[model samples]
Each structure stands twice: as structure tokens, then as C-alpha cells.
Target: MRSNHSCTVSSAPYANITCIIHDDCILPCSFRPTGTVVIHWYKQQIPVHSYYYNKDQFGLQNKHFSGRTCLFNSHIPHGNASLLLRRVKVQDRGRYKCYTSTRKGNQEIFINLEVKALIQSVNMEMTDETVTCSSHNIYPIPQVTWATDPPTAQGALENQTTIKTTDHKGLFTVESTLKILDNLSNHTYFCSFISADKTQVWTASWKNQEDITQEEGHALSISCIAPRGLQNFSLTWTFTSSSEPTVISRYDSRTRHTFNLWEGQAEPNQDLLLLGDGSLLLHKPDSEEHSGTYTCTFSGLQSRHIVQTKVNITVASISVDERSVQRSWWSTAASAAFVLLTVIVALPQCVRQRAVETSTASHRCNGAGQRWTDGLSAV
Candidate 1:
């Protein structure tokens, strides 16, 4: 009962469809609505899905596509034959053939599906002289690269170690670590995760701490400001004095709570305040305990930041000693000047008295000489 007239079957203008792995995707194909529709989907020559007799037919469907393929049945009457593919896999990337037949004629169209799982987040952390970069839940295994702000020599990165692993779903997890034998100050380290196809790349950077001076016994506010409008974020504040780094405080935006890990060294609830800018506030930091490196890491779903701040606590006793030394020097100089002024004033008065005495003695000697001369003349 079918006519020889060719049906108006049109292919998607965009033959390429990129879908995220583990997500649903649609392969588009349509034709003019004329008569009862019969559709069969194929990859190369392999049967993927079928529909006929006004219902879905799966007796001859491909094992790879079982329970994972469906057509827009409700919209089929409107000439929409788009196939919905569920839980896309990397192996599902290929040219798909959508063959449709009706009372008018039969036509087919080809659509290419590309599946990819992109790199989510690149996180970096530094502990002492070692820096680490990591990422997880990625498809098409990624490569890791390291660089420095000042452009370190190739030999400096010779000790870098990299590792890659796959999870149950065949997604990739990558990590790279490098020991910064070079000076850890004033240099910024960069890490990148690049997809195998080179289409997706995520980069994370960290700068070694420069000094932030805080005087002893002062209430200090170590800034670890998170990004604005960020949700489901976690903030961690850590301190490092010797070889080991210790967690001092933690805040999770999801829980809307802050945890102080410093125990006896740090005040509990009274020491922490969530500032408007998301900075951490600490009260009366102890010079001996808190005088070290403070690292604040803010991690969110889409972004990550690692900030290292060096807090050099100037000892209160040392400052007091310096002031005492300055005051002693000033007092000694003032007393010496007063004694010299007294000596100078007495010298002038003594000189005037001695001169008056010498003038009187000279007049008496002249009178005696005249009396002797008159006595000699009378004799």
C-alpha cells in the first residue's frame, strides 16, 4: 500500500553533537509527516533501536544500546524522530544512522556523536618545600605540567613526580608533585591539567608566602577572603612552624560553621569571626605558637585558591628592650651636657677674681719702690 514518492527527510544542519559522558544526549533526525512511521537506528551496520507498528521494537536491538535508547514517541506524529540516548559513554562516540520509512518512501540521515568528560577543578597545595597539583573525575586521561613564575630551568623540575589513575567509571584522577629545591620565596608555581584531545585545560597557581608582619600580643586578622557569590565552599587555615603543617581553623559554607583546631593555643568560639569579605579573624595570637607560615585554602565547586602568608611576630620583650636602650642613651647624653655647662660657668668667675688680685699687688710694689728712693736721697 506504499507509494513510490520519496519522503522529505532532512538531516540536522549540525551533524556533530557533543555530549558529556554519563549524561543524556539527543541525536536529531526528522522527516515530513505523511503516513505511519517506522524508524530504525544503527551505528555502522549494527542495529541500535527500532520502532514500528506504532510501538517500540527491541527484539533485534543492539546489546550496547539496550535500555539506553528511546525516541520522542509523543512528538513522532509531528515529524520529530530525535532519539534520546541515556548515560552516554566514551564508546558511544561515532556516526549514527537514523533510517525512517513511511507509506510515502524511506530515507536515512547520519549524525556524529562526540562524548567527553571535562576536567572539573585543578587544586594546588604546598607543604614545606614540596608542591602538589591534583584533579579528579575526568575522562580522556589528562596530562600535567608544572612551571614557575620566574621560569625555572628544566633541570630544576627533573625531580617532579606524576601519577594517573582511573575510577570505577573509567574517569581519570591525576596528581603531580614537585620539590621546590629552589628558593621557595617570591616565586609562583603553576600547574595545568590538559585533556588528551587538548580541548579542555584547567590551570591552578600558588605563590610562596612573603612576610606579613604582626607585632606580638596583637589581635591579628589573617585574610583568607573567598570569592563572592560562591556556594558550597570550604576554607581552611593552617600554620607551619617547623617541618610539619598544622590545621588551625576550618570553615565550611555548606555547614555555616567554623571549627577551631588550635585547642589550648587558640581561643575557641571567641577567637573566630566570619567577616564580610570571608576573612578569618584571630584574637591575640601568641608569638611562640602563631609565629610561622599561615596558609589559607578556599575550595569551591568551580574554583580553588591557595594563599600562603608568612606572619613574623616581633617579640614584645625585644621591642621593650630596644626602647629601654634608647631611653638610657638619651638620659646619659643630657646629664653629660649639664655637667659641662657647670664647669664652663665656674671657669669664667675664677679668672675675673685672679685678675683683680694681680692688679692690686702691682700698685703696692710701685709705692714701695718710691719710698726707698726718697730715703736714699735724704741720707
Candidate 2:
């Protein structure tokens, strides 16, 4: 006799089986049998899988589970009558029963198969300034929940979810967004996607990146690539100092150009805007004032989202290179003077020598006799 079948819980399920959609699910219902016993798995009194006489008895199996159902026959000797269900779907979420007929009597094992939708990959975007998190590629209905290290932030944020069914597969693609009314940092946003069976929560974290260092008077150009694709963004490129942040440039499509420090002066190519890149042609730090922190802030496009990237600018002087540039400039000026002197001093001497050679040739021809001068005098 099977001890597991001693006290049967036929009214409710013995256990709940949770699994993701399109993945394999195991409906566990096992009792140590004597030898070969009859096994029947049912859903709502309908036959899903049946096995008897030491083989899979699928003649009476339901057509809906054809080629998609299997019994763990290798474990038949050990009485592990777990049924493996393949390629789960939303319709597979239901209560099921397992009937095992033995020499002692008939045993009933019940199970609740709960299949949930899943997102294989989640793309999360976080903005710490406003505490907003956004992501797509989710499934079913999604909700956003706020969580902190100490669990202080709860019910303080709001959730916004949107879902659309895919064209060919008909699977749901959910977009979950959250906004924290009170802005703070060092927090994480959780996006919970719930289906009929289970709830999966994904987290979006807020953390700063590494700082940057550069030599003074060298060109600096960095890609201000934001993870979020804001339709229209109000970007502010700022250089931070000990006192306050000075605006290098601020622009948006609507505002055009709010303020640009390098607008009139040539150098650093003012054409390369802050939104594009903060570039200064032949730019150098005047003093320690230029060396501080810098950041590009993007806002307004996303209603509750504020994205910012900080760059700690350490402007170090290139002493050797600076002296070399000075020396190179003076050397170039001296070389230009030497070339001009060579041309000026050598030109008049060559002209005077050519005039003397012509006079000498004329005297030699006059002294050559009347015979030689006859043809020349007539000409």
C-alpha cells in the first residue's frame, strides 16, 4: 500500500504547480506502487493523460494534449507518477487530478496547474532625480512598486501600465512606468508583471557612473547618449564649480537656444550643441576654475522622468606639452625668417653678376676684328 495515499486530500489540490508560459511544466503526483499500475491524469474530469500495463495508454487521452503530454515512465518502478506537460499556454491554467489504480484500491492525487506569462528579458531605465522607472517587453498586466533599502518608500509612488498584443503570436507586450511624487535618490523601482498564476517583479536601480579626467587645452568630446528615447528633450549642459553650476549651453527644440557661453567666440565649434556634444575647438582651461564637474541633464520630454549624467572633470596641466608647443612656435617663426633672408640676400648678387657677364661678352665681341664685326655691325 502507498503511504502517501494514506490520507488523501481529494477535496482541494495536493499542491499548486507554477510554471511560465511556453515552458515545460511538471504535474507531480506520485505514490510508491507495487509494480505496473494504471495512472490517469484529468482536468475537470476530462482525460489529459493515462497510462496502464507498463506503457503510455493514450488511446483514451484528450485530443487537445496530443503529442504534448508525457508520463515519466522511467520512474514507474519507484512510483514517481509525475506527468510532464510541454509547451504550456494561458489555457493550461486550471485544476487537475491524478488517479492511480492499484491492487490495494484507487488513489486520487489532485493538483492546481497555474501557468503565468513571462518576460524573458526586461529593459529598465531609471532616473534618480525624479525617481522614475520605465521599461517595456513585459507581458500581461504590469504594476510598478517603489522599494528602498530600508523599505521606507512604499505606496509613495504611482504605477502606469500599458499593454498591446503582438501581431502574430498574440502575446502581450506590457510597458510599465512609475513616478515618485517626492524625488529622492538611492532607491530602486520594481515592476511587477502579474498573470493568472504568478507575479514577476523586475527592478530598476539608480547609480552613478565613474568620473572623468582630462589634460588642460586638449579637446574633449563625449557621447551624451541617453537610454530613454525622449521625443523632445530639454537638455542642459552645465559645468559645476565649488560655488554653483555654470551653464555651458541649454537648448531644446522649442526654446532653440537658451544660453550658450561659446556663442560669439570661435573655437570649440559652437555648432556642436550640448544636446549633440559639448565640444570646444582648441579649448584649454584658464585656471582651476575650468576644472570641476560637468553634467548633461535631460528633462521635459518624459513627464515624470529626469535623466542626468555627471562627469567629474579634472583639468590637469600638460607642462611638457605646453613648453614644447611654445618652443615649436618660436622655431617655426625663426625658420620662416631664415627662408626670407636667403631669398632677399641671394637675389641682387645674382642679378649684378649676370649684368657683368653680359658686359664682358660685349667687349670680347668688339675686340674680335672687323671680319667678325662686319656681320654683327650690318645687323
Candidate maximizing TM-score: 1
What value of lDDT does candidate 1 attain over all alpha carbons? 0.79
lDDT by residue for model 2 over 122-225, one digit each (tens)? Answer: 44555543433444333345554555433553556534444454533435565555554444354333444343334444443333334456665555553343
Question: Please, what are the lDDT tens digits per residue for candidate 1 over residues 54-120?
Answer: 9999999989899999999999989988899999987798899998888777778888887879887
Query: Candidate 1, after superposition: displacement of residue 7 in Å?
Result: 11
Estimate the TM-score of every prediction: 0.63, 0.46
Residue 67 error, candidate 1, Å:
2.0
Candidate 2: segments with Cα more than 4 A from true spot: 1-14, 20-24, 30-38, 52-54, 72-82, 100-109, 117-121, 125-142, 146-161, 164-172, 177-201, 206-213, 216-339, 342-346, 349-379
Tell me the spans in candidate 1 whose CA falls farther than 4 Å from its real position.
1-14, 150-161, 184-186, 195-201, 210-216, 219-281, 287-293, 299-302, 309-379
* Candidate 1 lowest-lDDT run of ten: 267-276
Q: Which candidate is the best by lDDT?
A: 1
